[model samples]
Target: MDAILRAAGEVLGTELSEPVDLGGSPRTVVLRCRTASGGSVVVKKYGTEPDDLRAFTAEAAGLSLRLAGPELLGVDDSIPLLVMEDLGSAPTLADVLLGNDPQAALDGLSAWARGLGRLAVASVHRRADLAALSAGYGMGVPSWDEEPWLLRHAAEFPAALAGIGVEAPPELAGELERIAATGANEYLAFTPGDTCPDNNLLTPDGLRLIDFESACYLPVFMTAAYCRMPFATCWCVFTLPAGLAEKIEETYRTEVVEAYPQLVEDEIWQPGIRRAVALWTVYLTTNLIPRMAKDEPAHRTRRPVPTLRQLLRHRWETASTLEEFPAFAETMRLLLRDVAGDWDVPPLPGYPAFGDFG
Candidate 1:
């Protein structure tokens, strides 16, 4: 610990002390430390593990874009550590959503949408710049935008379902291929990769995002699906009240439409967004189903969070209605019948902020 603080202090030209551990994953150690000048800087040091290096590379490269997040004060790639401006304590979006004010949650959700949309607009053509910075950090990990998530997760679909005693439909492969092709379309933009609710801080100035470790470019719909699935990859899942999801989705779409004017059309917009939703449903099957063996909060510290079965059932219910993929829709239906249908859990409730709605 002394050696790492010393290394980080050298980068900032000030000795750091009074370190407070800021719970990071096994891949990194994050600290909120007081500098010699009595100010605080968050110092993060990545582990020697290969994936840790990749995560470090992504964060350093993403913050360098200055699109969002704390200002990157300094980096010593040799130690694989970062010294960043402290944004100070602020309530996270998760905090707001889980609180008592429905209106605060509503406003926060809209602002979050607008902020992410503008970020996508700002980062549209900067892939190579991100690539160049990434190479300098961790021997050049692959840009996650190009990671073939759709095809890879879809390919795993059949086997994942089979593990649960449900056989995938024969024509499911064709539907998966179609959505994967749409996933590869030209409407790409940069995202912080892990835009889960807790990953961003709702500061007085605006929503200042953090945790750029999974940063990469991806189709805009990959994120737009969050507003539809109402947060596809987040641990803070709950039912959105009537019309709330679409309203926020429009708040986001309104900003991105500035970059791609054709997004104004339902023909161009609906199909892309729905396909992204389908892709994420497949993702949920692989990522969440195995976990359904037990019931617990999706997050360790947050309440009213959905359980794995709750999330899976919600996703499958939505996917079951996809007009574009009959085979896939049928598959979702079968899972609903054989897997989550008999569970004793109540229907997933609305966000806690909505008070009686839940």
Candidate 2:
């Protein structure tokens, strides 16, 4: 740590203080530094491949133009480092989301939408640059609609339903296939591929978007899809109030449509919402199943051992909670019906089909 800080100081002409962990997947080290004149700065060192450095540089360049995010301090070789404004007063979007104030969450979502709208607008004219960034971030073109994840979920529907104690209806698979096959060749746009609340910070200035590592050019609808996942899960799981979900979706939809009128059609919004719900459901099911399977004994010991039939009934009863949002409910209904139908699916617009299912 000392050696890295020394090297950083030599490169930036600053004396570094102790390092702090920012707690991300790859674990970034954020160092607080001071120059000889006592000016404070923050430096971030990322754990990523050299190729990913290109994406970081591109994001820094994009943020530099908009002046909406932190400032780029410098880079040492291919290791892109950021010198950002210290945001000690602000809380992360995650912190705000975990708070009791629903209005704050709504405000935060609105701010996020506005920031994203600005980003989209800013990138619209930078076609070549945006494309390069997308490539650097690994968002290559191909259809992701009929990806194996879709198939795995569709094929595993029976097991999932059985595990949850619901009857796996056969017709729903076909409907999902049709829904997946329906949209192709849609106009693409720049999407912040990672829209997790943790990626947004609520500052005095407004909601500041951070972590552009996954930002890429993709179908505009997919952006909506990406953003809707956490929102739907939070609402469905009862972590967020029912009405707040509608507010969040409306704010996002309004901001995007206001910026790009081409996205105003119901076909666009409806499909995007459905895709979000479907993808989120698959994500949750995949993540939770193993845990549930392993923890079932402990879970059952803590509670009553309902029959598998009763258990399945409980799962769907809980699933219906997600249906509180009219759009989400409709999508769930359609997806379930599709699974029942054994439908042949097509690819999603603008994303590659990565075959890994874990």
Best by TM-score: 1
Question: Cα RMSD for candidate 1?
Answer: 1.7
What tens digits encode model 2's per-residue C-alpha lDDT throughout 1-358?
6766776676676677656544433445666665566566666666566435544554554444443466656556344455665555477665555555656766776777667665665555555665443344332222122134445554565466566454534555565554443443344445445656656788777777766554555445545654444332221111234454556566666766755686778866775666545545654554455554332321222121222222222233334445424443453454345432232322111101111111
Per-residue alpha-carbon lDDT of candidate 1 for residues 123-197, written as tens digits (9 for 90 to 100): 888988897887767544555554676788998888888898998788888779878886475788999988878
lDDT of each: 0.86, 0.50
In candidate 2, which residue ranges exceed 4 Å CA deviation? 48-68, 133-187, 226-229, 232-238, 283-358
Please identify model 1 stretches exceeding 4 Å from their true place.
none
TM-score, per-candidate, Cα-based: 0.95, 0.63
What's model 2's TM-score?
A: 0.63
lDDT score for candidate 2 against the true structure = 0.50
Candidate 1, pairs of clashing residues: none
